[model samples]
Target: MSRIKKLLMVVVALLLLAVGGLYLYKDAAVRSGVIASGDQVLGADSTTLDSASLDLFGGGLALRGLKLKNPEGYQQPHFFQLGGIDVDVSLGSLLARRIVVPSIALDGVELLVESVIDLDGPRLNLLTIRDQLRSSRVKNAEENSASSGQRFVIESLTVSDLKVMGLMTIPGGGSWPIDLDVPTFEIRDIGKKQKGVLLAEVVGIILVAMIDKAIDMIESDGSDKLKIAGDIRRGLKFFNRGLKESGLDPKLGKKLLDDAIQKGLGDLLKKKKKDR
Candidate 1:
């Protein structure tokens, strides 16, 4: 019994050590990936993935203090930063020919637009990263199609708990800035070939929602507003149907998506102006 107890203790110790090693290794990998990626975004000098509170599970990972430095033109040295992301990677999809980014949940992010360049330029623009990700998905799909039978599929992607600033300019360059404080933003069936078209619909839906709010704020004329809303809804319905055909579970997808939006945008919208 004494020998058996000692053996059990050894086994438990080994297991704990192994788990610790794996978690540390994963943390190192993520740090390396961030440093390499940040080199491109932040040029030289200070940019780092501070790993004080990082954890890696079998199916998911959590990061903290993910900071990005801006180039010479940027107003602040560290122009943008994210507090954390708790995300689950789709390993099966990754093994296949596609970049299957299933979900990304961002928390406490800061978006600072520099006054140096046109707000529309790549550096200062808030949505540039999202646009680049979409473009890369298409380009990668085309490239990978030549190699394997596996098709890239982003079945669902959701982002929630965002504190946004420096959003894109509203139509016709209006003075009333259209900043977004999204508690949630999401996309489903992102791997489909018609992702661009679907994204256009999603954008339209958001535009419609914003326009309704804007009309209320600015006291705009009501003549064609109803017609515009109908058109936007129609576009969303058609695109949403396409998502269903993309081999994704629409019910689960939409639920997660809506949750993200509600947490991200809803919270942002509800905050008092001075508080934001």
Candidate 2:
């Protein structure tokens, strides 16, 4: 072979190696970032991801086996778990200050909502997570206003095949489980008005949305489990407060609480009191 041809071959080999190395680094970086950001935002005992892959040319990212452990004192193993997530990102925007994600889809999500009724009243796992996210958001806003962390603008996000399981721990150490299948839900234009939002904030947005939906489902149902909704509503005040602290619209949260109070909780509580 000619010397120039040999040199060309060597250059091609080096380029391939460089590309491979870059892919590996990007994969590891994405995995680490997801776990760290999730733990910080969720205040989980531990956050884990099985695998994360970035399609460099396609600007697509896939994540699998993501799990967020419950906070200390919760009986459930995980507060949240998902089978997989697929995200479509704008390649051009990756180089810009705010990464633009066109769509995100999460599948096989399992959320454990536990209410422990003890001497200290009822402690709900979902409420606890909400409060933790609120605190994290406040701390982030205070500390990282000028920091160079990656921010995102997600145009649309959807969750499918969601299972919301409720567990109640009674005073005698007995427990009851209620299973509910939540219909798929979607949110759009996240971080658009704000221009960009931190990753933790994105998580907070999703969690708050899910929590609101769960509460609605619990309240609307007329089964014996409807009683749980009353206990859950007692904590809705914190939910309202969390929405305000997390930068969500306070007026909307207030309206939700007011409507819930007007619609059912008052009547439900009165019935319980009369029955006892």
Among residues 3 or more apart in sequence or in different chains, the pairs in candidate 2 whose N, CA or C atoms overlap within 3 Å are none
Checking candidate 1 for backbone clashes, the offending pairs are 182-264, 182-265, 183-263, 183-264, 183-265, 184-260, 184-261, 184-264, 184-265
How many backbone clashes are present in model 2? 0
Residue ranges of candidate 1 with Cα displaced over 4 Å: 1-24, 38-47, 52-58, 90-101, 117-153, 166-180, 192-276
- The 10 consecutive residues of candidate 1 with the worst lDDT sum are 167-176
Please give, for residues 96-133, the per-residue lDDT of candidate 2 as tens digits: 88888999998888888776433333456777777777
TM-score of each: 0.43, 0.72
lDDT (tens digit, per residue) of candidate 1 on 200-228: 22322322333233323222211133233
Q: What is the lDDT of residue 30 in candidate 1?
A: 60
